[model samples]
Target chain A: MDDLNLLRDLGRALDREPPATLVRQRSRLAQARPRRRRPGPLVIAAAALATAALVLVPALLRQSGKAPATHRPGTVKAVNLLLVGADGVRGDARADSIVLVHLPADRRRVTVVSLPRDVEAPAACPGATTGGRLSGTIPNRSLTCVTRNVEALTHVRVDHVAILAYAGLVEMVDAVGGVEVMLPRAVDDPASGLKLSAGRHLVRGRPALAYARARHGLGDGSDLDRVKRQQALMAALAKAAREKITNPVTLARLVNAVTSGMVADRALTPAFLKELATSLERTDPATARYKIAPVVPDPRDPARLVLDEKRAEALFRTLR
Target chain B: MTAPPAVPETASDADLIRRSHDDPEAFAALFDRYAPMLYRYVARRLGPDPAEDLVGDTFLAAFGRRDRYDLDRADARPWLFGIVTKLVARHHRDEAARYRALRRTPAGAVHDDPADAVAAAVTAAAVRPRLAGALEALPRRDRDVLLLVAWADLNYAETAEALGIPVGTVRSRLNRARRKVRAALGDTDPTREEA
Candidate 1:
């Protein structure tokens, strides 16, 4: 053999990894890039004020088709709430966690489907999937955009959105008195401040916050792992919170935490939240299924993600 | 006269880097073109874990410094590879340990160098494992130059460009690298003593 044969052996060894990985990394880099900050305190304040007004209202007003369709009982038919967890709101914001908590007409099951952030814009051009080439608008209005994308992607209209910054998540976890989470592996990411060794961890408060917010220090360090972690934490939080919602003290604590740091659309009222909570309280937490929106590489743009139409439709139907 | 249909303009890497100054999105095309090959190259040297972070950082670094990129160089391959080479250099211990581990460890999982199973040809099997050993034995710089040529398939001039060394230095380094590898192997390579 020649000196070159060692290289050939090494190349074949390295090349064993699937090409999907490159596509995923490219899609992630494209979709999850931090946006540049634009000076807009006035706009943020105004939006915050509007959100405050929404929070104060007893019931949200909506006409049939004009409203984002939800299935909430009492005031609405179904409740579709987008729980957005981002580091901050104003500048260069991306929702590190987006979970669409869908309460069906029956309201027996709480389906929290976590959409993979790497869902490339369908209209993205070649090479647009990596940098500021296209879709810069997606990051700033992450909750708004992702909810809309989820609606389009799943044929499930998202009616309410709650943007919970890290502070709110900490409070919420504490309010429910934390949750028990079994690690798929030992997570030790110092980036997002998560450093738990793998085991059944009774995560709460700051550690719980770290667990949910951690985007690194896990398997493959893909956003997919974070998505899975977020889903698992959400389910655990829900299960824990379900037992305590009947207690006035705990409920009041949750309200305080949620109102302070949680930004929401005007439609999500305290009454609606109570009603939604009551509905989900009876259901088995095990029944709360989570899904990352099924995706396929765009035939036209290889790096970009598009809805896996058939499987996605099936998933939505099954969840619905 | 009727205008002929306009063909879409395909931007070269240097052209894209130049254009990216105005339109940052133009850089993704370069990433799509090279990141996989870059990942594989790094993965072979370091392993998968570091390769993921290093490869991502390499692109970000390339994008960060895109404006300062040498426009005279049309291809981004050498430039991208050079950035990753610097990153791999930072993990001197892990990189050294990797070569040592490959020497002592049995194959699979951590150090799965694909044995030349199909390419036995009733000939080159004996030669390749020795080459792996010789690779382990060489000094870091010579190993880098040899691997940059042999592994990355860069031309001698491109290897010189990637490593920021003179063309003559690349020649001497590669020759020195291969001589040591061949010497370590002794009579395994039929053309062994030519060096």
Candidate 2:
């Protein structure tokens, strides 16, 4: 037999049919596609805060027909905005990251809490059973289901909901010329194609997204480590936003990028965002606290996590 | 306005890809069509364990770059193959190990199918080890060109498009690879009639 034909025969010998259908892959693809129909909220409440700090001031002033004025403390109420980084098409999307942004009644501090996606939580939605990973609730139920669960767990009301797709996250990061991330050790994660040496690096949109998404080949290979990275990325984004606010051109680009990237609840109107932004202006990036909800491995499934009741209550009480 | 006609089953890959730009769900049709063949091709190189994930990754990567696709090209096979090829390169070690393992496997060990005629099976079994050893010895690029043609059945033009190389380069690489394979098989020029 000719060598080419022999090679063909060898290929046939090695051929195998995949064990199962491509359902998992199909769903993954579905999740990766950016949702186009819904215009939701931005990824980082910090992005909104920064955008509001510079971009919205003039717009708000024009609407109110008032001279330049600062937002006084005690005028605005404490707000809890649920920022969800989700994947998949609308309605069936999965919440990969869930962060609660709390602005105190005094607006002196901004406390952003990262809730690990694998934590077990009760389902507060009607006709839904209790006890599943918080992230799973979004796919099985609606985004409202996830919000209700968060409220039930923390005893805090969710005033606004914003979902950011990965695509939007990329755009917002690039809009501000990229965010600086500090890695203690060099990372070369093949899965996500995130290659960065140890130390500080200013990563553009795609690499920033990869850094946030990569879990393996990093610390402990746990989901909590990824949560920490996400928090760090958000803080860096806020810092970048603060730095870029001085440049009107970059500020305009950021406003356009941030607004287009997110899908927000109707309640989170332009006026409301402006108010939130103005209130956050006094907040210092150094004083902004990032916390992960207290968690312990679930007794039933060690791989999953259950909130440590006492510590979680303490954490939630602080947010309240 | 009247509702647009449903996408026909016979819709070209480029048509589906264009539709997916507007409706992301439309990309699933492309997945359903090409995934099986793509899976088999990857499985042939990397074994079954990584095949499923790799194929899935290929489709996901393709979906992300769907807008950049040359809509003028009616067939997405070459494009899909190109994505899979790059992914396979990332796992080059696994592929080389697979080939080395095949070289060690005994003749007729894999071709034990009852449907195969005894004589043809013997011929295939004899050549399998030598072919695998030759493949393992070839440089990664030349092997890529050779396998895309011999295994994937992509013609010279399609192979060039898939690899992002010129047609002449594809010809030269394939020729060099075939010469090595023939030498590895001892140049017996066995008079077995071409299938």
Candidate 3:
């Protein structure tokens, strides 16, 4: 390999080995033949400290991205796009997945909000096709059902929204690598082709998607329960992406894999995608906080849950 | 002179050095592996020119103290690093000045990439003026931890050992340093946002 390009890049700083100075010093020390002394408390403490240090130090470094290189900062204010995806048989492109992310310029902090797909919400400005007469009416559906509705009503200015169908989700999950989800309860959904035991399973691609999608065998058999599971999986995906998206080759692969079958608003052009990708380069998962919108289990309808607006507002206030 | 047989049982770097006190070559191999990392750490803190001298001084000091060295550990990297940290401590003025300089220059201005010349210059123009004062305001210990971790890539444990503190202490110091840096840098995300 041509060493220059590899050596000069920021990653090289991570991989560089020390030079000859140490070797020369070591030899000098070896020849001097220092006398060995009996074990003492100081020596013992030093040894203990070293042992304690060895195990703890490496793991902490692993928490952040490998190492930051000298790259120019992005030339704009922090931009956040709340990505949401949902399943809607009869709606004007409701985003089923919700990811509220704040991208800062320094690459220091990223805040993400993952919305439950089954959250019941009112539509802000219902489009003509949703079969609604009320221009600003609440829909009798999950939060995922009213994502675009909420965005429009609130004038939250969603930069982009993407919707992925079940099969597409499976393919995307498979492409980047599988996602890990912990089953709080046993789940067996014949229709979704999911049969998971109550343990930690590394489900990739299609099976993993099924696991994320399965609600029949989970908590209270509610879609909100499944949404919680989906959020957990996304946290894992973000971490994996932090490590995986380091190289340009892998980055291109990811962009191709995700963008090809993905659906987004027309404003999410190629230039916007580049800007977003560049913006996200430094969002390590270690520092980011993840939370779901607060919702109370409906007392009227036991199977459904309603958004706890008061607590949710408090949480959103902190985010703002 | 011929060296002793390589014994699997005599396993630490310190042990190897102890056993091979008669063989200078074996000891040299261990030194070679760690010197540059220490040098870079010191240089980043102290600057390139004097860093060379301090690095040389650190190794020489290590050589003088090797007789007192315990051979239990196979790697001398951490021990050598500790010595360099102490050496840097003796020249606190230079270290402080370096941080001050770093704060003045925009992070982009430090780029080694030729292609980024224009962008870096523009970035430096935008952010460099405000950063220096903010950096100057940070407590010395906090600045030390931030620079070492960000520039030197010392893991928290290694930083602790080098700084002669507990691991928890290192983490807290780092957190404080980062908070100050973020605040000074205007709470902007460096990767995607412009200054």
Candidate 4:
């Protein structure tokens, strides 16, 4: 056949089987939504209120975390940050979720640590990990373990920690429309209703949040299982942010939503967030690698586990 | 005076870029118009299915980055061809795979008479594989300029406009791309070389 005929035939076949089949809502239609046409004064006041909320919320949350000594004099070199999330609403207690961030000394590599919830370790705080002092909450235990382990292993200092809640995660997901994920195994949990087939899926705001939190529904039913899920979801989120939504206006809206009710270490600022966005924009999804912290079965107790310090340290060192 | 038959609504490359920036559905119109021509060029060098996907993706990406449009240029062929050139290079294996797939299928009867069929097939057999390999091996810039002119039928000025390069650059690149293709095809005749 001639080249034109060959192309026509192939186009027909491809038309029969398109790569993407999802129904996407039109962007212009969304933009065309009704407006109240507020007066200039009211519009200005609303803008001011939104700006104040963005600045105050994160600042207030940062103050709640343990204030590490700011600005340790060193070659302004690569920094590793441990961002922890706690379940508790109060300010006095420790964090629950832990993400060990390793910024390469050359600023080329960024590795993250996701500590499992049930891994037993010596309580770092007077009663944080064991919840012996503060009602022994799960979030408290997780926070204590992360802080102690981070300080013990790597010479790289924990630059700052940000404690984000389920609400914060949901709002962020909603702001980004939804996040896409790949599940190696099926999830059939009644509680979360996270019935996913073994393949790719587009998890929307609420479902995506549930997927990150659902521990009991996955294979081998443990917090360890959930940690892996969280890392995969984070990678997928990064990919979607890079490929599907790279516009500044979309990013600013996302920042507004995520930073709306967030708590952070006083050290992380809006300037830092802007810088992070710029770095993130240049990066392609194919280059990023996400792995959970390695763990070994506890020698003392069969039911418990601990961080493989030697292996974990090696992993963190590479991040440097 | 009776109005002449209405010509179909067609936008210049600059107009298409502006429309693409404002409306994606309007941009899809450009894809539908040019994808066939683009696909045919690719299919001749590669095969069919790979060409289709590559052509679609080229238009999709071009549409997505419509804001980067150089509105001064009236034709988008060079930019579109540039994307196709990159994609084809990246998926060289896929093109080979397509050839293998084509080989397995029965060769359909050529449109000419029995005598011409044999001659045409004989010519195609000698020309097709060498052409494919040589086309694939050309430097990306030269290949882009050559195919945009030879297959997409772009003039030197239009090719330069599409590629965001000077007309002299287009002429030089086309010369280089043709010389390489000719060398691969084993055409040592002085007349063919001059052409």
lDDT of each: 0.63, 0.77, 0.52, 0.54
Q: What lDDT would candidate 3 get against the real structure?
A: 0.52
Evaluate model 1: give its lDDT.
Answer: 0.63
Q: Candidate 3 lDDT, tens digit per residue, B62-135?
A: 66666777565556666777787677778878766765776566555455554554544433434443444444
Select the stronger candidate by lDDT from 3 and 4: 4
TM-score of each: 0.52, 0.60, 0.40, 0.43
lDDT of 2 by residue, A81-185 (tens): 888887633555667899998878766677889999888877644443334778752553246888887998889888887776666778778988999998889
What's the lDDT for candidate 4?
0.54
Candidate 4: regions farther than 4 A off = A1-76, A88-96, A127-146, A153-155, A184-186, A270-286, B1-195
Clashing pairs in 1: A70-A78, A71-A77, A71-A78, A71-A79, A72-A76, A72-A77, A72-A78, A72-A79, A133-B25
User: Which candidate do you rate higher for TM-score, 2 or 3?
Assistant: 2
The sequence of per-residue lDDT tens digits that candidate 1 reaches over residues A132-238 is: 11123334443555565556667777777766665666777898788887877887664454667888989787788667656766666766676777777777776
Best by DockQ: 2
Query: Residue-wise lDDT of candidate 4 within B32-136, one digit each (tens)?
Result: 456666776676546555665566666666765778878887777777776777777787676555545444433323222454445445334434445555656
User: Model 4 over residues A138-167: C-alpha lDDT tens digits?
Assistant: 443234345555565444577655555545
Summing lDDT over every window of 10 consecutive residues in candidate 1 chain A, give the lowest-scoring window.
A55-64
**Best candidate (score: TM-score):** 2
Candidate 2's residue-wise lDDT over B1-195, tens digit each? Answer: 012336778999899999987877678888878888998899999988889889889999999899899999999999999999999999999999998888988865655465543544656776777778998999999999998998888999999999999999999999999889888888554634444
Better of 1 and 2 by DockQ: 2
User: Can you list the residue pairs that collide in candidate 2?
Assistant: A31-A88, A39-A263, A40-A262, A40-A263, A40-A264, A41-A263, A41-A264
Q: lDDT for model 2, on a 0 to 1 scale?
A: 0.77
